[model samples]
Target: MDQTTLLLFIAATFVVAGFVKGVIGLGLPTIAVGILGVVMAPAQAAALLVIPNLVTNSWQLSGPKLKAIALRLWPMLAGTCLGTWAGAGLLEKAKDGSATLWLGVALVLYALVGLKAAKLRVPAAHEAWLGPVVGVLTGVSTAATGVFVLPAVPYLQALGFEKEELVQALGLSFIVSTVALAFGLIGAGALDWTIAGASLLALLPALAGMGVGQAIRQRISAATFKLCFFAGLLALGCYLVLRAMG
Candidate 1:
């Protein structure tokens, strides 16, 4: 892509990604990577996501709930950091179309469960053991695919969090995942100043789109937004799967 085209693409991609995140409280990385991956290399795409992901999620993390949520999530957060470090090695060694395939599979599974509106409950007793396990999986997936929702989102859902709490938890989880992924990318030499600068620039458009999405959220039902979200995920998943196969 030329300079003009690349600028346009970045503007458009973040607008869409941020809108989704504004509405659903997550999906920035998934949407950004899914769209940008079509036109660029995976490592570069992942690198571009680092700054925006961290910045947005940090905003989402600020609230009275922050401390409570952090206490609740410390174990998972720790596991995620470790897993991302390990998974970075996997990313470095990835061959064929494994990264795309993994991303495709993760999207499809996430969409299916979301579309079904499945309500899974984890007994409190299970959370200590399960949360870390899920975090590790989410970290590995994020490192390899630049998509961080997988087991993390589902596990959060299973906790039966109130809607607001769920949103906060998602923010916290994503913040940790983004930081971990950035470190992983830096270690792998996938993140550099140029991509980081571009990523920082993308933040404005993303924040602007979030403003628009937040307005729309007031007018539309959450159920409607969720339906659209899952539908989009399904289509994106199919595209990724086919692209990998082709």
Candidate 2:
């Protein structure tokens, strides 16, 4: 794609991504990276994700529960960082197609789980062992696919956090994962100033779309929208998988 075309497509991607996030409170990076992977290399798509994911998640983390959540989740966060760092090494050595394949697989799995309304519970005492394991897997997934909602989200849900607390915890985990993923991308030499600059600029459209989505959310049923969103993701995932196989 030409420069202008690439820029417009990326901006559009984030707008859609942000709109979804505003409506349901998550999925910005996953949506963006998933769609963009169709047009570009996966590492490049991942590089484009760094700035928006970090900034938005940081804003989300500003809620009052930040400190307590951070304190409680530090061990998991540390394990995530280590896993991302290690996974980056693998990503650096692999072909871009591998990343794209992983992204597709993740989208399919996440969509299926969401559609099923799957839930699990973990006793508080088990968190110390379980959290780090989930964190490591989430980090590795992030490094491989630039999508971070795996065992992490499920594990967090299992922890029995209240709604608001869960939101804040998700934000904190995304922030930590985004930061770690950025470092991983850098270490793999997948990030450079050009992509970083474009990523920074994409924030405007994302936030604007968020505003639009927030307004829409007031009138529409979120459950319906989320169902539509997951359906789209499933279709997109299928396409990506097929293309990769070809």
lDDT of each: 0.84, 0.84
List candidate 2 segments past 4 Å from native. none
Candidate 2 steric clashes: 0
Candidate 2 TM-score over all chains jointly? 0.95
Q: What is the TM-score of each candidate against the true structure?
A: 0.95, 0.95
Cα lDDT of candidate 1 equals 0.84
Model 1 Cα RMSD, 1 decimal = 1.4
- In the predicted model 1, the residue pairs found to clash are none
Tens digits of per-residue lDDT for model 2, 46-70 = 7888888887776667677778888
Model 2: colliding residue pairs: none
lDDT per residue (tens digit) for residues 38-126 in model 1: 88766677888887888888766666777888898888888898888888955555657778877888888989999999889999998
